[model samples]
Target: MNTTYYMSYKLSLIASLAGLLYGFDSAVVSGAISHLSNYFSLDAAGTGWAVSSVVLGFMIGAFSGQFIAQSLGRKKALLATGALVFVAGIFTAIPYNFTMFIVFRIIGGIGVGLGSATAPVYIGEISAQKIRGKTLGFYQMMIALGILLVYLVNALVASWIPDSQWGTDYAWRYMLGAMAIPGCLFMGLALFLPESPRWLIDKNRDDEAKSVLTRINGAGYDCQTEITAIKKSFQAPAGAQAQSESLFSRKYRRVSLIVLTMALLANLCGINAVLYYGNVLFENMGIASARTAYYQQVIIGIAFFAAATWAVVNIEKYGRRRLLIIGSFICFVAITLLGALIWVGIASLWMLVLMVVYILFFGGTIGPILWIIIPELSPNRIRGKLMSWATFLIWTGSFIVSQTFPMLTDSVWLNHLFNGSFPFFLYGLFCLLWFLLNLFFVTETSNKSLEQISAEMSQA
Candidate 1:
């Protein structure tokens, strides 16, 4: 309602558009996969490569994103990421060959990696603790929205274009290139956002930090208190030597391990693999046609959007660890049942229902909470670096799942062993593992300030 609150919201909203681009780029390929495969005469492996290449680029970008953010500041880094997404989108749409398409997809993936690593960190840094979870949840919500929008676009484009044109090339090209619109918007808006005040303080720009903090905290709020806390968070404890510390340093090792484990598990549970190749997965599962699969993807996107919206509204109320554990458990059940249905040759419609249920739980739980918890758990001084590491691991797991799902599902040996449902079974197993990990290792951080979380991690 106040100037500070409005500005904070506006800035976070702009930054969160990066998530939209990430989602669009990630899911747009779903609609294009069959068309591209047909056009290029791709084998299963090549098809997998086309879908997973972005995640590989995402891994590299996330690995380097922290350094880029540290050197150029979050705003500049985000601007650069947006530009990359725009260029990658245009080139990807117009690529002359399969190799060129893969290259450009990787370029766009680099943008996704950069945006994924930085946007939530930027939102986390700028938001007040009271509303931080919801603010960061905005990033996840945008991601869901982007996925939903792309699915709709894919359906609409398929409908508008005749089968002759849609089958040849234009439909998929248009679908992939449409991302440039949002990419350009994100780049344009990044110019108006203030640098993370925490980043400003890290750079020893106290006056500038304070100016931004005042705008965030508003009149009648004590910006000085938050400023002092931010300073204190960066100060080394008594008798501790100040030096550049590795992310795996003794002080941070436990937290880093926890975050990395969570990140790895989140992706290993096969959420993105399902999302990126949803249409293909459904078709393989006996969906009537590619158009029907596309429609099913739209339904999945709607469920995802609904669940994400609910998570955004209630994350602060439920606490991160609780939601994660519950969500993982539900996903575990849904995935296992879905696999059983496939193995037993149940009605395809029931499998679709279970898929929706899996996404519902995923969107509400691990989908959004992973972003919130990683940043919340990190100490401010190294939050960016640690987040980058965690995100890199997340993408690594995603890359593995995305690249392997086709092979795993298509493998004759595994098919004989698992009744052709090996991938879902594996995902279910990871969901159970993720639930146990969260239950045992993760601590609740609801209502805690960043400084308090830092102090707790230091003590641990």
Candidate 2:
């Protein structure tokens, strides 16, 4: 193929909106958590549950995500995710009671989970090898855009409403309700997207797969050869000691473990903790005004989007393994410094600087890689289900970290020695571990076809 990818780029960008919806849903709560807790009169644990209740939906969606995508086809599954987000966003904002709130939030979380599970794979499968990294990076960048959208929405809503009214009821509702925009947008975009060519080949729809592959790679593309490669990827590798039949089989076992671990650590490194609790973290870090903290989140959101843009532009320029290793190490250092700032009760400006630096490396490198690597590591024979496993781990880590953050930070005993820095130091430790794991285990997959990467993993 001579690399005509304009159509591929369009399809991939539209498919990437699932990520935007996911990001919006994930980050919208940050501006509202404290107010919602106050409104519901929740204890520390109750507040945690309030935030984590949605994560349960994420786990459920992740558990079932692959089946849904496999059965419905990637495009339809993405449409389903958008519908879930749209419906969940509406109910989440206007719940009759706390229980209702939790239920609806979980519903929305399901959409987020589905998006997390499907979009990257859809984008990757549709893009050519020359631009696959950038396409996947587009999904990651959309995630950042979603976060930035919500942050801006949250800030505007906060600034518009009176503080008393915001705390009493409106802030959380409005902030959450805003998610419907991206959800609706994703649905519209997904309706126009072509189903993944690899997916079509798996279903034995060779002509349809050929059509999509040609559209993606242009008229000159070797579509039949590509189709044959996809089909070959489904078979056990030549000369393997044992026939590998499933994701858990010897052929994929190591990669499966690697995917699951990376998924968990992706959130466990404290990104979600900071994102879901932005206002609270800033307050604890010494920002006195809620308004100021909300504005600060916008700044952080901007930094995140910038990093994501950097990722989209540079993921191919820098090899995946190098970016992951370097980013994780920088994240480790940034987080440690962040912890030190909190322990010593540093100024808001100093804390903000470190927070942006952490977000920069994380959002720029490791964050984007996760969206690609988990899918990239799986063979076509079991890619969807294998990715669901990793998505499950991602949600698991997200739930654990988001739920524990308030309790850990508020714990008198836990924070006695290090002040509010204990949990962060703990998170920083995971970042260091993340750095070492990528350094030692991950191999670069730049400029390779999906089938090529699949074969390499089987041989690993």
The top-ranked prediction according to TM-score is 1
Among all candidates shown, the one with the greatest lDDT: 1
Off by over 4 Å in 2: 1-3, 237-243
Error of 2 at 390 (Å): 0.7
Per-model TM-score on C-alpha atoms: 0.97, 0.96
| Candidate 2 per-residue lDDT over residues 1-460, each given as its tens digit | 2347788788888988888887898888888888898899999999899888888888888878899999889888888889999998899889999999998899888888887888888987888788888888988899899999999998988888766755658888988988887788888878888888888888889999999888777788898887877888876667752557566687788887788888888888999887888888888777647778898898889998999999888888887999999999999999999899888877668778888999999999988888977788777777898888899898999899989999998899978888889988999999998998898888888988888888888764
lDDT of 1 by residue, 285-401 (tens): 786476778888999999999999999999998889889989999999999998898888775688888989999999988998898889999887679989999999999999999
Q: How many clashes in each structure? A: 0, 0
Which residue ranges in model 1 land beyond 4 Å of their true spot? Answer: 1-4, 164-166, 238-244
lDDT of each: 0.88, 0.86
